[model samples]
Target: MGYIAFTIGFIVFFFVLAFLSTTFSIPADAMLPIGGLLLLVMIIAIAAYAALS
Candidate 1:
């Protein structure tokens, strides 16, 4: 029950942040690079977690 509530709240927060970003004048091409960087960070985090455990 607690985890479910937390998940809902986290999703709500994400959408709120996404709505706020809509007002910005960001370029579409920038997303590819940012997404790639985030993906790299995610991979590194998972690798480190696996190595530690």
Candidate 2:
């Protein structure tokens, strides 16, 4: 349950970052790497939780 909540939080955080990136016209190269890292972290967290469960 905690892990699920954390995953949700991370997703929201990622989207917020994305929104900011777009709204502010962040450079593609920087935004892409950061976004990819965030997504990768989210995936890894979810996978870890699933494996543990």
Query: How do the residues 1-53 of candidate 1 rate in per-residue lDDT, one tens digit apiece?
Result: 44554455556555644564566645657655655565566556556655666
Best by TM-score: 2
Model number with the top lDDT = 2
- TM-scores vs. true structure, each candidate: 0.51, 0.55
Residue pairs whose backbone atoms clash in candidate 1:
none
| lDDT score of residue 34 within candidate 2 | 80
User: Residue 7 error for model 1, in Å?
Assistant: 14
Alpha-carbon local distance difference test for all models: 0.56, 0.79
In model 2, the clashing pairs are none
